[model samples]
Target: MSYSLQKKLVIVSFLFVPVALLLLFLLYPSLRLLQFSLTNWNGISKSFNYVGLDNYVSAFQNPDIWKALSNNFLYFGIHALFIPLEVMVAVLLNNKLRTSNFFRSIVFLPYILNGVAVAYLFSYMYNPINGPINALLETLGLESWIQNWLSDKGIVNYSLIVVSLWRFSGLHVILFLAGLQSIPNDLYEAATIDGAGSWKKFIHITMPGISRVMEIVLFLNVRGALQVFDIPFLMTQGGPGLASTTFTVYTIQTAFKYNNYGLASSLAIILMLMIIIFSYFQGKLFKGKGE
Candidate 1:
């Protein structure tokens, strides 16, 4: 073979290896997970039974499962709101302002910290008796507002959502800032010359320009919110009677705590399907492809 042909063959071989390995490492396991979702296998047995749709039926019937699902809706309802909040923050930072970098780093710092550490840190701060949060409430003469942050089923999910907003707002802020930079300053100047108010300018100029970033961040928030586990795991442990058990946490509990890999696999399959559906619709929304 000539040298160019040999080089082409070598390059193809290099790419082929990773593609084959990716199928092995990623695709094969996902296929197995789908298969396991239909089984009666306990994950340690030599023998197995085909449960078919029974696992999924049970998952749908379980109230713990429903609570987890509903809480996901509520969690994501709040999670979705962060996009605008981050955009607002980023726009402010993007303006000609002193100390923009300082504030940006301060906000982004939490994203680098461990999720579990953030969860546990909040857990300590939310402690009812001795924590500063409650103490500060009492000091401000709003002692009535002080309640068990993690133990109160009514408030635990909300508390977890607040912690989530703090943890991830920085990330979305950075994404929005990147989006903001991609907008031409001349457009804003033109909008101002056209007598556009801030809100009008945002609607016609800022929002349209940032649609791509909004799509990116919206997708990230949806996926991240669906897979949210660490905060509720460490802070509440799906606690106050499963008030905040997200899909991921329930999957972990089902697999390890109950040793029911079949059920866990069922949950995993459903979670995957739900997220895929969400992503599909979100993509359509961003592309203006579907209603």
Candidate 2:
């Protein structure tokens, strides 16, 4: 084959196959989910009545939808805030302090635990009656602070957010520490010679060097937060009066609970759109970090 023809064949073989697979696996199903979101199909009898934007309208109008959206933002915000903590952990580990590796391993061990385990773990930790947290509170003579962490309408979601932070922070720490290790010691030494204090060095030298890694980590963390299901599902089941319900949880409830498959699919599509929008902004933010 000619060079151009060979190159075209290579592209077709290497690149196009994965592209097609992605379309088949991801894009097509996303389109189908979008279709379901716009119709009234019960996923039972082979009949679907087009409901137009009614599913989305219902979703937008529903108080629970807005609440879940708002809470998702909270989840994202908390994740972002914890980036500093992740950095701190990474930095601490990088110092090669005694037991640093052991401590890092211990911190990262939780991420390997399944979501159900984390939820159940948090549930027990937050149990008002006999959980360890309450026990500690009792010991400290702060028993009045004890309440149903999962059942409390006001604070259950926040409690879950804390659990999420603990679960995912280690991953961010590892990624950031890897980035930090890549930075040459000479630069840090140079900055030190210039009389730059620790804060100044971090602000000028370290932060700029790690900005790209931060961008990537931030995007992934935000995307992950948007898709969270297991923790909320296992612990609260989006319950205690829907206080912790997420968009995904709401979709599940509509599908299995009320047999509204079409509506459920429609909601799923809307969520996909939200994800797309958020992902676009994430890319923009990452690009801005480059400039």
**The candidate that achieves the highest TM-score relative to the unseen native structure:** 1
Give every collision pair in model 1: none
- For model 2, the superposed segments whose C-alpha errors exceed 4 Å read 1-20, 288-291
Encode model 2's per-residue lDDT on 26-143: one tens digit a residue. Answer: 9998888888877888878787888899987887788877887777788889899888888888888989698988988888888899888888888888888889998998999997
**For each candidate, how many residue pairs have backbone atoms clashing (under 3 Å)?**
0, 1
Worst 10 residues of 2 by lDDT: 282-291
What do the candidate models score in CA lDDT, each in turn? 0.87, 0.84
- Which lDDT value does model 2 have at 195? 88
Q: Estimate each model's TM-score.
A: 0.94, 0.90
**Residue pairs in candidate 2 whose N, alpha carbon or C atoms collide under 3 angstroms:** 37-266
Mark the regions of model 1 whose C-alpha exceeds 4 Å error after superposition.
288-291
* Candidate RMSDs in order: 2.1, 2.2
